[model samples]
Target: MTALDVPGIRQVGADAFTWLSAHRDAFALGEDALTEDGHVDATWKPLGELAQTCASVCAVTTPADPLHAPAAALLDFAWLQTGRGELFPRLQRLEPFATYPLEVYSVFASAGLRHPGYEAAAATTARTRGWRSVEQDPTRRLGVLKAERRSGIRRPERAAPLLRRTWLGGLPEPWTFERSSGYALTHVVFHLTDWGRAPAGLPAGLAAYLTHWLPSWLDTCLDAGLWDLGCELVVVAASLPEPPDPALLRDVWPRIARAQLPSGALEQQAPQDGADTEPDFLRCYHSTLMAAFAAARTVTRLPGADGPGRPPAHDGRHRHRGPGEHSEHRERRERSGPSGPRGEGVPG
Candidate 1:
């Protein structure tokens, strides 16, 4: 296994967050943000993503870490953008059945920001049949369940059944993995683990499966220049019960780091057909946010790293093993080698 390059990973995170902070205004919601016709994709999603990423960074890292303060500041800024949590209730009132308001607000709630009016309203809305029956993809349903948990709203559905419904939950054949499914798989892990703050939240079976295959998936993403998904995969690797092999991370992070523009933004997709055109903020925001998230999650897992509220270090108690698998089998696998050759036929 390659030696872990902690400094390199930190540098990638620092640059990405600095860029995000510098361009913070671009994440602001427009006048139409509260309107019926407002495009949630444009108006709310980016800001919500900012809050989520910032909150995750703050959750695992101490205020002393360079990444923590900016993330905290950004979280504050995002909360302020919601009119200090007032806008959420108004948005909820406007679209009572809409799930985005609760989903976005939950990130703030998890970060210690609260709005009584919004939570009260969401609680009532969640009890409605309309809200209860809202249809969503399995991955999205898991996200909503997680949001409800974070917001302290009561709901009857459990995550295990929902997990079984999603693509990753089934532990499907590795060859069947594709880009969209890859994102779905990563988000499932994020939701289950609370964005990497609690790796034990991941079931032993799932953790063992990922420990065996994540390297190949990560290599395929990096080889294809899928920076956004690649960063997400890195987060999944770090979130596993066992820390990822340092060699896998060391080999891929530099390629991801090189993809970042000097200004610190990372494009979701490199320009197609070899064009050199620069991507605007809309194209770069998510990948950059993810890069910061990936970095913050990873540093906490590295040996000798410290964070304010870092979870107890893995001590074998939480180490996941496949059914009937023993310590000797795991030891042999660890000693057997680095990851095998890259997976073939992986779609971008």
Candidate 2:
């Protein structure tokens, strides 16, 4: 496995997830943190999203991996405990519907973990409502649809228009690839295929867009050392209609690995004052979590026996990709009527 491995992509992924699992106190949302309305503090939102994505990515990977089951279970426990899944009573008023929770649910379904969140009527209702309300915003609506599909729910996708909206459709001329939008855009890509479960999830025009511009966007993020976003772009590349070249992530993986602290923490921002000023756990928990997940996902896609089941890599990197046949799936994605006529290429 080591011989076939690509340095930090695997090792750092394992270490970062380990740091998170061990240091649950610093990153996880507390039970009491929810407001009277059942809404968690905004502070935990990004961390929660990272946990959700990590749990999903961890779910399908090898069972023996240290981070796999534990991460998944922790997230499940947290979702149920937080009353986010309606496992318990909603102590406070409900937070207005956001598609973020659906992202977690979609990942959970893709990972095949059985949980009420996947089937809870409330959760489904929230997701369905979110999808309907976001008709004007295709990116968000597409994300919600992906969650529903990945959760094994059926969706008509578009209303009576007959031209169904793909995830990439309905964006402005200049791409919104900033941190928040980058995650949103990349996430939509992941959802397009449900994290590679359905390669056909990659629509024709979107695939064409990616084939032309992804390399530059990925390179820009890597050069900026935007480790978190870079990781997502890597996964986006991995989930392409065609098998991505092993060389795609070759340069950026090592740099992300290099950002890891001795404590297994992946720094979110530039180094702050000293250890004295900083707590044992720094503020970058979300980035670290996402970074690890990105690495694990990329490794599984990389060309090697270490992928998904040649042997128990046990590091989450050995997981296999879900089934995807480019030609057929792309056609289906095209037929769905998504990728709604964006002339400008990939966002800068």
Candidate 3:
């Protein structure tokens, strides 16, 4: 099987943590300019590096396929656009970029790169930090703008309405209802459980939508406190050869939330809005993983599925022949094995 088909890749919990820790230096560009609130006041490095790091981590660890390219490109643009040229403004601007629920629009909003008015705030932040001049390459910035426009991905708008929708009862800003990082195998197990729990009667297109944006949204839920972080980690890490680790859950549970109503839940329950309700984290998680599962399978060579690079039968349990079918398959194998061409024959 290809790397894409190895369920372990989907469970990217520990691996993602390790990757991020290793690359912490790469992400440390404006650490000096960051405020207590998570903003970046400077632009010491190109934002592209952050995007590349996120994309590479996702691609190498997850079963992400064709969709990863565009996602990565979009993130790259967002990161660059948000980094103010000077150090101080960059710190104030970095909050949205560094925060959870990585929406496309928020990247711009966080960096004070969106609209004419935001420039004033960015400039003010920069000035406060005593960074008078910023020598940025306009072309590099333009490239990010161009890519974001081309991607056609919808970014979250930083309007009051969106904020109100996200606020879970005075919960902190940029709250993730859930958050997790680790191996891809954890993701697969979580995906299976999520799939099994899917409520009946979802439209056919739902799965497709979830796969493309699940990771970011899950980050949002974690940040928003809609779900417990330990639960997410547990769900993800469930796929290991051994049962899920109790110690892992115990360690993180204090930081994770208990089951609680999301801030948005009250709004849905309230009357007269007339807007289509946002789906809960459970639905979002399930939808994303299901789509990922389907996407991963698309790139894999499964048994009974014809392909140039089909997997050898002996490596995994999936290769086992069924009753009745085994007899004929064995007969064919025996006949073929005894007289097959030495070099051309399939391996025993």
Candidate 4:
């Protein structure tokens, strides 16, 4: 049986919290993505993503573990950093780079954690403004369409007519939505799930398209060593109203497990021959978290399946690998929401 690397999950989660905690300031409200200039204005969105991962790791991990409290604290710090939510004015100003409307804050809200400073007004305002921008000029609204769909505030009224039809139509392939970041196309599916809010936003056509194509998508991403994106898709697959193909889910595990490192960091991607970049913990963090989240939940409601806390059987994909085969040595690698009470389901 091959099951997920539970210890690896724990270590990666620990490493992420440690690395992120030490470098949390790097993801401060306004730090530049490429240059990472320090403490400027707090307008960026990486922190929101970071906080989401932290909350996610905490949610799956046993609460008795030592890292649980620290993970929860990370969310708290982020909430405080936003001045109880005032910094979003600055955060929204940056736009489309690392932040999204509903998706950003929803990460915390879904987990039922508290961020007293959460600004419903800011999220709503961003949603309202983005809809107007899409209406006035439809040419560059791909990003806007996605943000509004994910904003969770409401579908942008202006784009609503187009959204149900031509907006995101015809993406019948895996490579169709490659905008930016590691998980471009996968996130389209994610946003539809409202960050795992139950695929409330997934259009029937898109869902049908995914049902036909998702298994292969998982394979291609795995074969390509895009671990980060693959796991995101795993979560995407899990959120589908019907379960994903068991064969597809079974195939992804060993590839991910084999790539894991002793320290618990899963390499950000599969290694290529003579690849110069070394596997780094920071790079491995997101992928590792996703894997843990999948392992923690695959055994439950996600796709209405479960694969947690135990060993899973191996398969053909677990072929013998030579040294430096996949990432050549990189391997390895959540939460609550803000508000009323601890959430009861997947953290969207």
Top-TM-score candidate index: 1
Give per-residue lDDT, candidate 2, residue 64.
Answer: 52
- Worst lDDT run of 10 residues, candidate 2, spans 309-318
lDDT of 1 by residue, 1-348 (tens): 312454378888999988999999999988999999999888789999999998888888876688887887787788888988889989987999989899999988887777877888899889889988999988898899899988889888888888999889998877666777788889999999998988999999999988876777777666677888889999999899887776666666778888888878888777768654557888889999999989888888877778446322332122111112234324543443333223332211
- Mark the regions of model 3 whose C-alpha exceeds 4 Å error after superposition: 1-64, 84-89, 92-231, 234-276, 279-348
Question: How many steric clashes between backbone atoms does each model show?
Answer: 1, 7, 48, 41
Evaluate model 3: give its TM-score.
Answer: 0.22
lDDT tens digits, residues 1-348, model 4? Answer: 122322233344455455556655655554352233533323434566666655554554445444556656666676665564455445545443333543455555544532333345544555555535534222124334444443344543554454444324545333442313224445555555544435556777777766665555555556667676667777777667665555555556656666665455566567777353536544665666666555443434333222221111223111111111222111210011111111121122
Residue 231 error for model 2, in Å?
1.6
lDDT of each: 0.79, 0.54, 0.29, 0.49
RMSD of candidates 1 onward, in order: 8.3, 8.9, 23.5, 13.0
Candidate 1 lDDT score relative to the true structure = 0.79
Give the CA lDDT, 0 to 100, for residue 65 in model 2.
54
lDDT of 3: 0.29
What's the best-to-worst order under lDDT? 1, 2, 4, 3
**Candidate 3 per-residue C-alpha lDDT over 174-220 given as tens digits, one digit per residue, 9 for 90 to 100:** 21222222122123232223212222222223323232223333333
lDDT score, residue 318, model 4? 16
Q: Give the range of the ten consecutive residues with the poorest summed lDDT in model 1.
A: 316-325
TM-score of each: 0.87, 0.69, 0.22, 0.60
- The alpha-carbon lDDT assigned to residue 241 of candidate 2 equals 72
> Global lDDT for candidate 2?
0.54
